[model samples]
Target: MNKLLLFIIVFTLFSCDSKNIEQNREYNYPASKVWKHGVYSKYEARDLEGVFDGLEVDVIYSPEKNDIYVRRVVADTSKNLPLDEWLAMLKVPSKMSYWVDFKNLSKANAKQAMSIMINLLTID
Candidate 1:
């Protein structure tokens, strides 16, 4: 009887702790796209355009004008280091990816759009 009781007690404590751990990670919203992806800034927007020199700007995804906006991840230049600087400092080689996949995508067009997106989106 004591052994059975102890087993139940241990199981209960383990289940309780696991429940709390899972609940702690539940957040109210989807993670920000800018925060999760797009490694560019507003300042970089104008400058980076030069990286993709001679690219056209057009939206592949659009339901509304205001609905579709440039998605970007920006460094708090004053506080956070610039993206290029961070890339330079990394001890190990790393890569960052930006995307431009809409409902209808042309590989060539998407490539160009991604270029514009990278150049235009800012931290604000």
Candidate 2:
């Protein structure tokens, strides 16, 4: 009958629409505007809490204390920023991506570094 044919056509159209929606459901993240910027570093005089799309830093781990330090070189203790304080200084912690360049990260300090990053950066 005409009613049966109409019902089948409507169901087919809805099924195709649903399939199209599913195919376009992929998430699109925002692209970075700035290539690179400094968040906190001794070399730059900018504020430590400045807003940036990404952070490029050199990290060094202290074996004795099991703590992480941010510095260009491991020997330069004076310019080092502790992991906790550094995270606290970020203007937008959640929105920023960190490019951590671990300096002299030995196998002994690898676990400690991972733990420090997880504890500080993990959003509850």
Badly placed stretches (over 4 Å) of model 2 are: 1-30, 37-51
Cα deviation of 5 in candidate 1 (Å)? 56
**Candidate 1 lDDT score at position 54:** 23
| lDDT against true structure, model 2 | 0.66
- Residue-level lDDT of model 1, residues 1-124, one tens digit each, is 9999999999987777543454456534423333223433434434443343222221232222212233222222242433333233322212222343243345645655455446534322
User: Mind giving the per-residue lDDT tens digits that candidate 2 earns over 1-124?
Assistant: 9999999999887777543454556643436655354434633312432444556777788887778877767678786677666766554567666677888787877877898888886642
Each candidate's lDDT (Cα)? 0.37, 0.66
Give TM-scores for every candidate, taking all chains together and pairing residue i with residue i: 0.21, 0.61
Q: Which residue pairs show collisions in model 1?
A: 42-122, 45-119
Q: Report each candidate's C-alpha RMSD, comma-separated, in the order given.
A: 16.9, 13.3
